[model samples]
Target: MVTPCPSLGPPAPYVRRNVTHPASLSAWARLLGRYARCIRGRRRDENRKRGSGMEIHWSHVEEISEDERHAIEARLSALAAGHTDMIDLRIVGRGTGHHRHGGKEIRVACQVRGREIVAVRSADDLGLALDQAIDAFEREVRKLREIRSTHRDERPQNPPYLGIVDRVLHAAGYGFIVTDGGEKVYFHRNAVHGGLEFERLTEGDRVALNIEAGEKGLQATTVVPAPPGVPAP
Candidate 1:
């Protein structure tokens, strides 16, 4: 019996196997174009801000005067010249007002470009981009405030707490605190602030402790054993 050579499969079907997948070079170019525009705008805004920051605007907060208008134009021009293509830049808000007829609130958008920022915009005109930028800036400011207020420690920090000695061997001079969270914090006899050695500690004994960082982990220091009837503090 004779078999077909099997080498005669259609060329079109075989060639189609290597066909290139669909891709959108033009779409990518358009998307990048839009992004580029946003970046350029940000840079221009930055330059305007730098220039405006150097010169004072109108003394009155209520309005923008002729001098301020010229200043704003010059700053914008400077930005156009220096920063034709740039990306996300810093903006420091400078002023705020309402649109005519109190239609909407406006916040000044200032950013740095080149040697200085020359960009300026009313927040109302900046759209969602400006809103996000302001929110991010405010978030950073809040975090900084928190960092400044709290005590930063090179070592780990934990909350001070009150506990009760669940068990202690007077001879061993060591005990464990049953924390309010039901966690046990190991303590040595020397941890007692009163310098009085416990005769014998047992379960349900109340105590006060200042949580401390230890070699292993969090431990209790300045322990004060409480009498049977009183709660640990």
Candidate 2:
């Protein structure tokens, strides 16, 4: 025979039962359905926000064909390849004037880096107008890129002042380098490197010059051909 163990403080209190009225149950079911729907809607909105990374706005002249729109999108994507920021494209089409022969106008504005680059064109034919506008837009984008590249903050390994060969006195073996900054520095034929000769240099020739203070003043100690591809000052 086995002895029964003593109860631990009688039996613990019974578990609480979840009791609800019919009306309450219905209200809870409805509340749960609404919550689920809200969750689904929020998810959809998030997905859409992710998918539409670029914001493109289109307006009247109704002249842009589907194919042309696609082409424009492709071009813009190429322009925005390296940029992770949002790109906004606003395109407008309208008549240049109210006159009978007034040409159509297509205007495109690209928002980049907190600046707006706008291109506009008017043509007798709608397609021609669109083409011209796109060309102009591309040119604007290219110009912006060039400006940014030139003004970028990165330091180069061997930075040199950009200048032009203003004057050359072959006999004296000395010449002046007129920097884009409008300052002039003196250089001698011996200072030119890379097989460059004072005799071969002409006025308005682009060059990169390294300057230092000499007994006379700031002098170009070294000069070369704008480092091959760099622009003159």
Candidate 3:
């Protein structure tokens, strides 16, 4: 019997493999475009989440002109530049009289790490109100900066406190000292002149301590035995 060569069975019936698909380029391009879009969207979301370093929001100022808004923003930015710790400002302006007759009142608030600062002002006109409020806010910001700078400068210049060790917890590695002013200040073993010396401390031992503000209250930055013959103050 004569058999066919069997090289192929009816040309494989055009099963349409991926390599033979006409839409492959377009499909790949669509996928790449979608990926790009996804990447761009993620970046945009990240940028929004991070936000600009400092921000200002407004309320009830829509009645004011654009130029006025720009002026107010610029003034506030100038005020904030001096205080690096200041972030997030909000400005609000309200009309006191019906039909915008009497005057405008403005309030400005800013945020710091641990506190909020605010200023308020009023005037017969929107421009004047904004100007006065921003000026007051600037002064407040300046005063805050000066006060903090002064506090930091005073810390090292101030003399160490004179005290007597009123209590000691050898097991806990901590102690307390009574200042000459009768205030009890806390001290940890780390604050001692040497950890080994802290072990020798007794309830009545005299100590000289450098006082500082702590989360729980007054504490000693340095704790050392008082010099011989020095009276506890």
Pull out the clashing pairs in model 3.
180-233
Candidate order by decreasing lDDT: 2, 3, 1
**Which is the better candidate, 2 or 3, if ranked by TM-score?**
3
In order of appearance, the predictions have TM-scores of 0.28, 0.41, 0.42
On lDDT, the candidate that comes out on top is: 2
Q: What is the lDDT of candidate 2?
A: 0.71
Better of 1 and 2 by TM-score: 2
Score residue 128 of candidate 3 by CA lDDT. 80
Which digits, one per residue and each the tens of the lDDT, describe model 3 over residues 1-233? Answer: 99868666456565755564668888988999899567545543443244323556778986778567766665665555534345457889897774444378888887543346788877788778788888888887778777877887657543467888889999766788899899999877656773338778888877777776654677786777665687654
* Candidate 2: tens digits of C-alpha lDDT, residues 14-88: 898898889999999999989956754554344334542344667895667767766776666666554522245
Error of 3 at 160 (Å): 18
**C-alpha displacement of 61 in model 3, angstroms?**
0.5
Q: By TM-score, how accurate is candidate 1?
A: 0.28
lDDT of 2 at 20: 88
